[model samples]
Target chain A: MSIPLALASGTGRFYKHSAKIIRFARHGCTNRPFFHIVVMERRKAQHQPVIEQLGTYDPFPNEHEEHLVAFNFERIRYWLGNGAHLSTPVAELLGIAGLLPIHPRTYMTAWRNRRAAEEAAAKASESGADANKAPESKEGGSGTS
Target chain B: MSFGSNLRMFANKASLCCNVNKVTLELFSRCSTVAFLQYDKDPGPSFSNPDVQKLLKSMTRVQLEKVYKKRSVSDNTVEYKFMTSEQLEKQFRKAAERAEKLIQMPPIVKVKEDSQKVISRDPALTNFSNTKFVIADITYGVNSSDRKILVRQTDGTLEYAPLSIRKRINQIYFPHPGRKIRLPRMFEPEHLNRCLANFQYEFILDRACVQFDPYEKEYHEITTKVYNHINESKRFDDLRSTRHFGPMAFYFAWHQIIDDLLYDMIKQDYLKNGAELVALYYQLNGIDYDKSIHEKLETLVQPQSTIQSVLKPKASDDMHEEIKNAIGKSAEDFTADDISFEFIETFVKTKALKKVQLELALQALRETNDEKKKLYHGLKKAHGIS
Candidate 1:
């Protein structure tokens, strides 16, 4: 049987081609709502699906802890193999979560290191300037005989 | 009867009604004018006049007596009460007994062993030539029981030794020129702002990576289009061109890419889990990725996405249209590279579509130029045939 590219139910919707899913829990924490995306098998039930846990997506803070929607990645891959699809939003989320690569280049670590170095250099320069100013003011007051 | 005699009778009556104590009566007699005067003005005579009757009722007899005596009425029956000889003798005996008990009582003031008074005078003059002020030396005797610094003010009155004075005097006397007040190193606003901006870029880049799923085959086409658009704009070049490799440029470049990706996601519903996708964006951006931030972003994007989904509006809706129109009108003044379609799009979306319409109209003008060339070539070929 051909795998459906996308599937939608009360929990959320998933797009097979994109390998993403958007899961919105109807009831869990108090009155506040929650949503999540889990990669799972096409044939498996969303809540009981076999997959890897990636992360959680919570909407309301007033609710209990369980209202949060969590994702397992291994389970998601299993579902993807079984022909599960992800929705567009879920696909983007996966990309942001680092499950998928969105940008052509990754400069996260390099950028952080560069920034730290710049901050250190700036701090050093500022301290040096302050040190130089103190002596200059002292020298101005005292002229050689 | 004379007003003085009348006042005296009134005082006796007032004393009987109020149950005044002996001491209180004596005090009142000494202070009140009525005690020295007698008053026998028959209130019955005053009763005939309504005003006098009202005044009499309002002003108690004792009060009236006082008023009459104060006016110097001489006929006074009130005699000042004095202690009799026997009563004086009894009071004297009681006083003697109280004095005896006081003398007999054991000493109530106990001398503590550790009680020592310390006199701290300002060291006649501060010696600030070379010594540094030690906080420990000043604060040492402040809370101790043995050390008491009696501070005599200029007026010779002793003021409790001020603890702060000791510290101030010590500092002035022993000045530390090299004593630096070290403050915590803080991030400069500009630098921090730049860092935050760079962090935002990284975050955006991370979000783009997730959204586009650069590794995925299906996302390959969309990623290429976005990359091409970014490269064409030389947006990344601006980031690299800076002499300083501060993450700010990278951050801004990433921000642009993420915005494009988010725009795509919103339009296409590319990410199945929109909230999670946004959360990831926040995480990579170095944002707290807390529930509130997600909720806020959700509120902003969700409605926009809903509108886009139903209307299927072009990506131009995401751009501010006002800036686009401004650029279009002034296009002659700007270089081709300076014109940002993305900025124009943002302006059009935020301001109005008129500018975008104008931009399209300008493009049509370019198209017409191409048409003229085609026609010219055709006419030349026809002339050659003839």
Candidate 2:
């Protein structure tokens, strides 16, 4: 006779479909710690054994040297297809890596440009009325001109 | 007889100086007696008369002022005051030197031909280091519309800027130029300090204009020029690198750019009319509308007196009831606008609510408005509650 298999009975987390893509801190020989992009149960601790280690991120590598961030793109795409939500920093990293579409949060220069454009538009509309008045007054050389 | 006897006795007592030389001794005794009386603490027999004492007391203040002539006696000691002619002479000489160093500018409106002589290498201007030469004989060219503001740059070149730029800067610091920053009454230290303050403001404005002409299309070009100029010029570099002025360089740059950005908005006719757009602007900028600006905008829009007429009745009772109902209502039911938040803020502030009362009011009102959640949070933060 076969025993009935129960989901979440072993992990202590109730319900099915709990997955998170997180940056897990991993201590290295160097003074600074690096990160591991992993697929894990939502309830599991960061240092707990990950379901699958998909990538590595070395943020504090030697000066003038490019830091390494490598990942299994196929596994990432597969997990992403399975409705795995990307954390903000992880999404930013993935966006930079070209594995995912560009994240809006990471595009600060675009946001600044948009803001400057909006401001210019607002200023133009505002000054449109008074612009004629100022030039007129200046030309007239009226009181205190 | 008593007065005569007292005078004779005093004269005989002071007669020791007569032993030196008859004529010289006589003059010395007279002068010494007067000086002695001026510096003396105790009343001598000659000064014992009530009438004499009263007369001396009345005339002493006036006499003391003129008696010094060019000499200044320092009251360094508590009990005894002693100063020789040599010491007085030395003090007088130092004072003259100081007066000479402090170049007194003629009336700001008047153009003085002799100013050129006074401007060149004055001892007083030695303290200003580089700025002294520029400001010393600076000419003001007041034309029909636009006047040229000229000041000597660090590189011994006269840098020219527009009057409009100076006026804008003056408006920034001294909002009401006509009333405040009045012409100096006299060229004193305080006046000199005011001039220095103006110099700093003008210097910053001048540099900002050089760096970025807000109206011009060549923004990067102007900025690059300004950056290069500041770095290359010795005086500019000195100013930028100095501990005190280094931070102010950033401030000056930001001020110019921000002013350029805001100038169009502030000068708008629509904004000058009412508080609605001004309020929107403030909300956008995350700054509260200044009371003066608010009042000015209100007056410009309405063209009416701020005071409410006594004859006109107010709907304050209904307003109070509405506010009470708003306070009692749930967050989903009640909608709070900017005006409501402003009202609540003013209410809390005007009532001078206690810490506990303010917290209670905020807590009660927090549920009333979803839109003003950020504002309420700001209010809560201001009250020092997490």
Candidate 3:
């Protein structure tokens, strides 16, 4: 049997060696809900120690509304360039902030409903036209002008 | 009481009257009786000298009356015009009627028991009815204990008598320039006349010690307000239980209940006037507080919080279970990006983790990576690691 691609790469046959990069994660809480962006190893436990805390997102309306989200965009961009994966919620929040492309999974429920409605309308129009043609053809044999 | 001593006393009175006001001095120098007396070659006449005795003795009653009428020299330039016996009687009567109308007299105020020395008991002349003087004509002896009330004489000497002397002899107008006499604590005037004296004067509360009656309507009003407030609030019940600490101490102890805004207002008022808060607490339902009892009251009143409640040396199994559940949920709740030191500290504290267990947990989370070592050190530093 052929060796697995991951093992081949580790064996230095197919791909060059790659360094392990720590991923950024988000922790969220309510009661003056705030989000923390923390850097950590992928292999480590979610609650394990972090390499660094990038910034915070406070969605709650505090004394000022404009200060809802605060982040080191330069650091976030650096990490993103370094192939750091964003947590699902973090990706969605960033998408809403216009900082990144809209996350594919962010509005799944709304998108699904819109698609279903469009399909239903097209089917209804087709069925109505077919019913009209069938009746006209059947009646033309009986009442040809 | 001898003639020489009496002459010396009259000299001292003359010197005092001369020293009092320029207006009175000019009047006395111009007076026909004093003009006849030979004055020593001094800046002011040396009435204190023995030579003035002959002139003083030879002075007629009518001439003496003229000096007395013009002798009024208060701290202010208060002048008293000479009046005939009929005019003096009418003026004294008018003053008595005015006092009766203005002063809120207690229907029957007790003449203080100890005032017998100063308040002569000869009812006919010394009774309250006859004992009326024009306030302007009355000059006080500065020494409170002496209880000497002097009326200025026409010759610029003082007559030591109660106000009734004016009713007794119309021709004798006594005025002197001795220091203004405060109202005696023993003499309870029926009238509350603000115009009679300065309201800023503080009366001695101890009636036995002072000659003027201390049971003034204004003083009575303040003391009553404080007493009533203490009675109603019952906030000072503990302080009152001690009995040694007076109502003032009790009022001071109740400061904790006062809110910040009210306390600020009270503080401002207090700085403006020392007894503003004291008066305010009595008048309004404002809180009275003294900072001295803050720590004691805090210990006595506040309930212990959760962290303070965690006192056991040994960790309970239930506590461990709760902490493990909380940590597990917190770990699962987030995608691996966020780890909070504060949350971990709180969780460990809630478990009532032993010092050894805390050390073990901290060691488990300690970073080994070279690049992240600085961050790990920072976290530890925040947790108070040197």
Which parts of model 1 are misplaced by more than 4 Å? A1-10, A13-35, A38-70, A82-106, A109-113, A116-124, A131-145, B1-386
Error of 3 at A103 (Å): 1.0
- Which candidate, 2 or 3, has the higher TM-score? 2
**Model 2: per-residue Cα lDDT over B1-386, one tens digit each:** 11122122145655655456554543343323121211122222323334323222221112111222332336634445467966755655554444323211110011111111121221211111122111111112323123322332222233332333343333332244232232224223354345444444223323333333333223222232332233223133223212223222222221111121112222221112112332322332334545454444333333222111111243455533344343433222223233333533443344221334543545444444453455544554555655
Could you tell me the TM-score of candidate 2?
A: 0.19
**Local distance difference test values of all predictions, in order:** 0.33, 0.36, 0.33
Question: What class would a CAPRI assessor give candidate 1's docking?
Answer: incorrect
True contacts kept of each: 0.00, 0.00, 0.00
Q: Please, what are the lDDT tens digits per residue for candidate 2 over residues A1-145?
A: 2222222112223235666655554645456677766776776666555566666666663332334455556567776887776777778666544445546664553345445555665556557547665433222221110
lDDT (10s digit) by residue, model 3, range B1-386:
11112111236546667665654444333221222121112211222223222111211111212222332235436568999967866665555444323222112121222221231222111211111221111112222223333332211122344433322222222222221244433234322223112221112212222222323333333322332233333332222112111222222312211122122322222111112222223222233334233233224323222222223234555543344243332112221112222323333344221334543443444332222445444554555644
* Evaluation by lDDT, superior candidate among 1 and 3: 1
Per-residue lDDT of candidate 1, residues B117-143 (tens digit)? 333322211211111111111222233
lDDT (Cα, tens digit) per residue for candidate 1, span A1-145: 2222232222334444544433422324456544535444455555543243333454443221111223455555555566666655455334333345422222232244445555666666667669777433323222111
Chain B TM-score for the candidates in order = 0.14, 0.17, 0.18
Worst 10 residues of 1 chain A by lDDT: A61-70
Which of the two candidates, 1 or 3, achieves a greater TM-score against the reference?
3
The alpha-carbon deviation from the true structure for residue B131 of candidate 3, after best TM-score superposition, in angstroms, is 89
